[model samples]
Target: MPAQPDYTRRYTVEEYFALEEASDIRHEYYHGEIFPLDGPDGPEAKAGGTKRHNRLVQNCVVALRLALRGKGCDIFSENVRLAINEADHYNYPDVVVTCSPADRQDPRIVRYPSVIVEVLSASTEAHDRGWKFQQYQALPSLQHYVLVSQRRRLIEWYSRSDSGTWILASVRELDEAVTLSALDISLPVADLYENVETGPEEGPVLLRLPD
Candidate 1:
């Protein structure tokens, strides 16, 4: 891994919050640095999402919406920001599910999300599976962290176990379903890829551990 820029000009959390409110584009704040989230720049811009990625997000939203109806959980997309902790880490997940009544108090940010989803692209996959995943684990309320691949028909489910360890499960079969134990709902893999072109499973399967 290469070294990241120092970002000499760091901003305070309050300053970053103000910048986020005034900017037209979205930005993610971590520690003391603010990074843009959109345009042909920034981390997510490296391997910009394809048409399939967008469709998958929509499918997930629809599936999760119907399944979670009247369950006292509100679903949000990338439009909403997630605050992982007090000092650092604020992100915009592709899909967010919050059930805590406390989260309703803040409209600008979600403090506690039961489930957070990220649609992976070639550029963002590494950060999603590595750094971002590590940081997201800090949230006590996050029971499920889902990663959907746009390159292939793959879904990586990270569920928090009773012992507080994150267990990884890979779902690849198109006919199979992804069970979100935290939400008590299952989403069919086929439905998520509806009308989307997911090429052959070329690369190694995600989180393929020994049986």
Candidate 2:
């Protein structure tokens, strides 16, 4: 969701957690700032997932669920919070995968996701590519950060190398497949855009990542 700078009020991590529990809308907490992810303060409500966006997110769940079976890893989508570190960041990703036993025991959030997937929208595109990505990379367990275009047939896959360098790869064509070496599964671009329109108006051509 698009963040608003007008929100000047800051809350301690303790207060942020309490606010999240009491609030109806989901908000992303960064440091002491709270970025409301839904309602009037946010770019759009949590229920505002577009037809194509929601479809793509569900497709990711289907693909990940099948691929992760019997692997002892669990996949969570929407409404699940991912803590970047203990005291610094907490936000909800569209999809998150966690295999940590500690994460398995925690009911409030997952801290060690192996992968995070985001279905991009016009409002939240910049944050997803810029700040959000930077924070996700800080997680030691994160191996892949996947961005799926809701407006077009494109996927930007960012994988971390053994030396901690991030490698960027893009799959632009419908027939191309995005290989997640970490997960050992390749997702066909066509499969992600299946049943969804891909024309200029309906497609996500504007947010194509650089190769």
lDDT of each: 0.80, 0.79
Candidate 2 lDDT over residue span 1-211, tens digit each: 3333335787888987878777777878776877767675464433244676778888888878877788888899879889987796788898998878889778889989999999887667776898789888889999999998766678998999999999999999877988889878788887777787744533222322212
Using lDDT, give the best candidate's number.
Answer: 1
Q: Tell me the tens digit of each residue's lDDT in model 1 across 1-211.
A: 3233234578788877777777766777777876766755654555544566779898999889988898999999888989987787787899999999998998889998999999987666777888888889999999999999888888888999989999999899988988999889998998888888876533332321111
The regions of model 1 sitting more than 4 angstroms off are: 1-8, 200-211
The Cα RMSD of model 2 versus the native structure comes to 5.2
| Model 2: ten consecutive residues of lowest lDDT | 202-211
Give per-model TM-scores.
0.87, 0.86
- Scored against the true structure, residue 103 in model 1 reaches a CA lDDT of 88
